[model samples]
Target: MSPDQFHDRMWEILQDINKNEFHAVAAKPPTDKAIANLATSTGIALPKDFLAFSQKTNALCIMAREELWPEAKLFDVGPAWTFHRGLVILGIEAEDLPEWANIQNAYESLVELYELTDVLPLLKIMGDGNHYWGVKQDGTFVEVFDGEATTLECSFIDTYATEIKELIQRQKDMCELITKRNKKQH
Candidate 1:
């Protein structure tokens, strides 16, 4: 699917899951000049599809769980309302965005730390700081774990959609299990 189609589909999924409530924070789309500047500054030739995606939204952070489940321990490190399990797509630094959401920062740090020159960090799986989904100059998607990279056969957007679906399913299952246990206790 094209980048625009993927973006629309992702929003549809998120909106449906949240019941039309906004559970995500998305940065304003960056200009073409800004994208060009980023490419020049990073020295990594960003893929055309990725650039297209970025134009739609520079970055996105979704807080899938607005509240903690009953009888569940909250180990998340962020806001009180956040369950901390969601999706994050890294992009250019914006004034309103946190430092960690900057694609340039992530890319440079990973490259410097791991001595990697091929992979560019793009997507971050919330709750885990060690793993990332990135793309190569050749447009191959890769999963990076502990600084080691493994190529993924699927497209980046497809993988991203799958991750969102899995997260939603897990949340649903947890809610069901909790309800069942509560019923049994009563």
Candidate 2:
């Protein structure tokens, strides 16, 4: 699935789950100039599709700010939210280092470990402690778990959509089970 199509489907699922009460918390998509600046500042030649995705809309920060999936403890939204703010928080182009020591340290480690010049971090698996979904310069999708990189089965955009749909279904199943158990108790 294309990035836009994936996002549209996710929104549909989220809306159905929340009874259309939840709204997007992300601001408009970042401008092309902003995306280019982010690439230059981070010293990574980001994938064109990734830039296209970012331009479509900010990553899912709404779920982070709000407890969209209260029962789904497996869904950690922190990384997704924070990663979207990477350029701002990391101060990639700043003359001096970022004031936040931890942020600076983590940024350096990521840049060095991944040699971000060759691979760009696309999305972080927030719920799964210290894992990331990234894209290589050659357009291959990679999963970084515990700092080890593994190539994904297919393109990042399509795989991301498929995984997200499955995850949502899992959460829905869990919710149904919870509801049935609660009804029985009553």
Candidate 3:
């Protein structure tokens, strides 16, 4: 089917998921089974609505497709974000999935982004690509040609692992300071 055809059906299914009749997760609005059945039935490799729906609801997730995948729309919930000019959904995955995690990419991206707000000393990206992969170049966004979730893993686990940790600790400390100060005033 054409991209337009893909998008049209996608829109309908997304409306359903958002409307509460369908969900992506068994426990929540976007039930996994519902999403999978729809996607498979539609003949689309993956559901386009997953990203659109996520963008609409600000749904945080760590989705795995053909391995570990974290699409761009899902990963945008980060500080110092570098979006591709027109590429809506860039895919990647992160390794270290915490053994047992739910909505793995969403949780990872949310915490990962928040952690970087103040703690990242800096990122020096030096790579050759049209997208964010390999080494992060100044104007590039983290991207993956295949297995999107793996890209997330590489960014955080390989190149930026150290920075990711520092950012988390920094956020924790900042929160503690704020809490302490707030308690004193009250």
For this target, which candidate reaches the highest lDDT against the unseen true structure?
1
Q: Once superposed on the true structure, which residue ranges of model 3 sit more than 4 Å away at CA?
A: 1-156
Task: Estimate every model's Cα lDDT from 0 to 1.
Answer: 0.71, 0.48, 0.29
Please write out the lDDT profile of model 1 over residues 1-186, one tens digit for every residue: 677776776566565466432267778777667677777776777766677767777788765544534323566343322243667888775556576787877887787888776788888866566778988777778999889999998877677788777666656765675588689999
Alpha carbon deviation, residue 8, candidate 1 (Å): 3.1
Q: Give the 10-residue window scoring lowest on summed lDDT in candidate 2.
A: 84-93
Q: Which 10-residue window in model 3 sums to the lowest lDDT?
A: 119-128
- In terms of lDDT, model 2 sits at 0.48
- Residues 13-123 of candidate 2 have per-residue lDDT tens digits of 444334332233333565556556766655556555445544554444322223323423454343243222111111222233323312223335566765544445555
lDDT of 2 at 65: 23
Better of 1 and 3 by TM-score: 1
Best by TM-score: 1
The sequence of per-residue lDDT tens digits that candidate 3 reaches over residues 46-105 is 333333433233222212221112224654443322221111112212132221222333
What residue pairs clash in candidate 2, if any at all? none
What is residue 183's positional error in candidate 2, in angstroms? 5.7
The positional error of residue 104 in candidate 3, measured at the CA in angstroms, is: 22
Task: Give me candidate 1's TM-score against the actual structure.
Answer: 0.76
Per-candidate count of clashing residue pairs (backbone under 3 Å): 0, 0, 33
